[model samples]
Structures are given as C-alpha cells and as structure tokens.
Target: MDPAVTAAALDDEHRTFARLLREHQGIVATVAASYCRDPHDRADLAQEIAAQLWRAWPNYDPARRFSTWMYRIALNVAISAVRSAALRQRHAVPFDERLHDVADPAPRDPQAEQQIRALHAFIQAQAPLDRALLLLYLDDRSHREMAEILGLSETNIATKISRLRQRIRHEL
Candidate 1:
C-alpha cells in the first residue's frame, strides 16, 4: 500500500470509530460512571476509555462484533483505572469528611428511575468484572456473545450472570 493511501485508510477508520463512540457514548459513560464515586473522575475515566478504544481500533477484527470488542476494551480500561485509584487512596492520608458533599441522585421518571437507581447502586457495589457482566446482561447480550467478549466459556458466562443477578437483587 502507498504511504498516502495507508494514512487515508487509517484516518477513515478513526473517523468510523469516532462515530461509533458517539453513538454509544451514553452506554460507555454510564458504565464508567457507575465505577467511580467522583463525577470528575468518571468523566476522566470515560475519556480515557474512549482514547484507548481509538488506539486499539487499528487492531479491531472485522469478522467479530464491534460492540463486543469495544465493550471488552472499555470495561478493562475502566476497571483498571478504578483499581489504580483505589490503591492510591489506600496509601493516602484520610481527608476531612466534612469537606465532601453528598451527590444527589439524578431525577428521572418515578417508575423507571426507581429501577434504574436500584440497578446502578447494585452495579457500584459489585466487583468490576461483575459490574461489566451485569451491564452486558442488562444490555441483552446473548450468553455466547458475552462469553466471547469476556473470554470465558459460555457455561461460565451463564453461571456468572445468574450469580450476578442474585447479587444485584441482594443489593437492592
């Protein structure tokens, strides 16, 4: 391939990837936000996930599902970020509790909001991989697809999802 053509092709791929990100921005942000207690940190994590997704785009396999691949990368990045932040906090001096303001939950339609808030709270309390698994399950992904995305056996996916649902119910 000519240098200019290769560059152009790469540019096009980036653009397409950007479009996909924009289309699914809410899903990505919600997943990232659920992992963090700080709003600023959530936004930063979402941006980092987007950047990682862009960097990984060149290696994306066309024969596979794009959303599945993207979810795996985004979830991995977000989970790693949360873990790193938690490690740092563990080593830091404790801050004054009075300095922190409680975050008011977002307003939503009463009936729908109740379920959403319950689910969000459940997700925040779970392990990072469990959170990702619940998110994929809520998104209606099939067991085989979830297995492929998480690099687990289909039977494992089914079992994990069942356990996660029980955990979520317990949290609520």
Candidate 2:
C-alpha cells in the first residue's frame, strides 16, 4: 500500500472505531461506572477504553465480530484501570448509602432506570472480577464468548455466572 493511502486507511479505521464507541457508549460507560466509584473516573476510564480501541484498530480482523472485540478491550481496560496506582488515589463513592443519589439520571423509563441504578449499586459492592463477570453476563454475551474474553473455560463461565446470579439475588 502507498504511504498516503495507508495513512488515510488508518484514519478511516480510527473513524470507524470512534463510531463504534459512540454506538456502544452506554455499554462502555456502564462497564466503567461499575468498576470506578467516582463518576469522573468512570468517564476517564471510558475515554481510556476508546483510546485503547483506537490504538488497537489497525490490527482488528474485519472478519470477526466487532462488538465482541470491543467488549474484550473495554473489559480489559476497565479491569486494568481499576488496579492502577493512580486509580487507587481516587476514593470510591459509598455504594450502600449515597451513590445512587449521585448517579446521573437516565432519559429512558424511570422504572427501568431505577432498576438499573439498583443493579449498579449491587454490582459495585462485589469483587472487581465478579463485577466484570456480572457486567459481561448482563450485556448478554454467551458463555463461550464470555469465556473467551475472560480467559476461562466455558464450564467455568457457566458455573461463575450461576454463582454470580445467585449472589446478586441474595443481595437484592
């Protein structure tokens, strides 16, 4: 490929990646929010995921599913971000008490939004990996796909999901 053509192609790929982020912005934001207690950190993590997606775009295999690839990147970013020293300096907003009030209002049905807020509160109280597992499961990713993304066996995914569901039910 010619140098100019390659550059333009790369730019176009980045644009497509940006569009993907826009389309799945809520999913990314939700995943970020689940991991980070601070609203600002969640937004920052979402932006970091977008940036990582852009950086990894050139290598993206067009034959594969875009959303799955994107989900993997988003999950990795969220998990890794939460473990960072810089992220540790930021205190988590208390989940059982005031976090729900601090959450942004949803534009959709109020009942559904309230349910989502309640779920977020529940997930925020779980372990980090458990939170990621629950988020991916809620996103409707299959056990096989979740296994691939989380580096676990399909059976393990099934078991973990079953346990997570029970745990969430118990919490609620």
Candidate 3:
C-alpha cells in the first residue's frame, strides 16, 4: 500500500471503529466491568480495548458482525490486562464499596445490587477463560456467537456452558 493511501485507509478504519464503539458501548462496559474490580482499572482497560480495536479495525472484514469483532478484541485486551502483573502492580488502585458506574438509569433495588455484587465476586474467582465464558453466558449470547467470540467450536461452547450451569446451580 502507498504511504498516503495507507494513512487514508487507517483514518477511515478509525472512523469506522469510533462509530462501532459508540453503537456498542454497552459491550465495552460489560466486558470491562466483568474483567476488573477496581473502577480506575476498568476505565483504563476500556480505553486500552478501544485503542486496540481502532488499531485492529483495518483487519476487520465488513461482512462480519462488528459486535463479534469488538467482543473478541475487548475480551482479548481484558484478558491480557489481567495477565500482565507489571501493569497491575504499577496501576493498582483501591476498590471502594461503590461499584463501577453501570449505565442503568432505573431505580435499582438494594437486593438486586447485592445479588449483582455477589455474582461479580463469584466470577472474579474463576479462571480467565471461565470468566470469559460466564461473561458471554450472562450476555445471553447463543452458542454460535460464543464460539465465534471465543474461537471455540459450538460443541465445545455447549459443553462448557453445561458445566458452567452445573457449577452455578451447585453454588446457588
């Protein structure tokens, strides 16, 4: 690709990424909150995910669903952020009682908030891959979408979900 042409394409790709991110802000927020406990860390991870999404936009195929691509990038960035000990050590922040701001506007019940907090605590205890599966499950994604986002076969997604269900049931 010519230098000027490449720059133009990159700019166009970033514009597309920005529009998609706006359309799917909920997905970003969900992934960020599900992956991190600290509010500052969640914000940082969300920003990193957006930056990576923009950089990876040129590789995205227009025929594919943008949400699928965004989920993959967001989850990958989130997973990496959790794995990077140096990053965590350097940017560690205290998590206060106030939960990270979710976009919910409805008057939330105390019981519901407590339940959500409990669920997040349980999810935070799981392995990285398991956390990814639970996040997709919580999002009500179908097996095919989950498989696509996680790069697993549909059968694998089904089996893992079944196990997750069993575990959740046992916990409840």
- Give me the candidate number with maximum TM-score: 3
Q: In what order do the candidates fall by TM-score, top score first?
A: 3, 2, 1
Lowest-scoring 10 consecutive residues by lDDT in candidate 2? 93-102
Per-residue lDDT tens digits for candidate 3, residues 118-153, read: 766667777777888888898788889889999999
Candidate 1 lDDT score at position 11: 89
Q: Give per-model CA RMSD.
A: 6.0, 4.0, 3.3
**Per-residue alpha-carbon lDDT of candidate 2 for residues 1-172, written as tens digits (9 for 90 to 100):** 7999999987887788778778877667667766776767767887898888888887888887787788888888877877778786785622332333444443568787687677877777777777778878877889888887788899998998898888778776
Question: Model 1 over residues 1-172: C-alpha lDDT tens digits?
Answer: 7999999997898789888888877567656655655656666777898889888888989898888888888888877876795733632212112121123345557787577556665665667778778878878999988888778999999999888877767776
Q: What is the C-alpha local distance difference test score of candidate 3?
A: 0.79
Segments in model 3 whose C-alpha atoms lie over 4 Å from true places? 1-12, 88-101, 108-111
TM-score attained by model 2: 0.79
Best by lDDT: 3
- Which ranking of candidates, highest lDDT first? 3, 2, 1
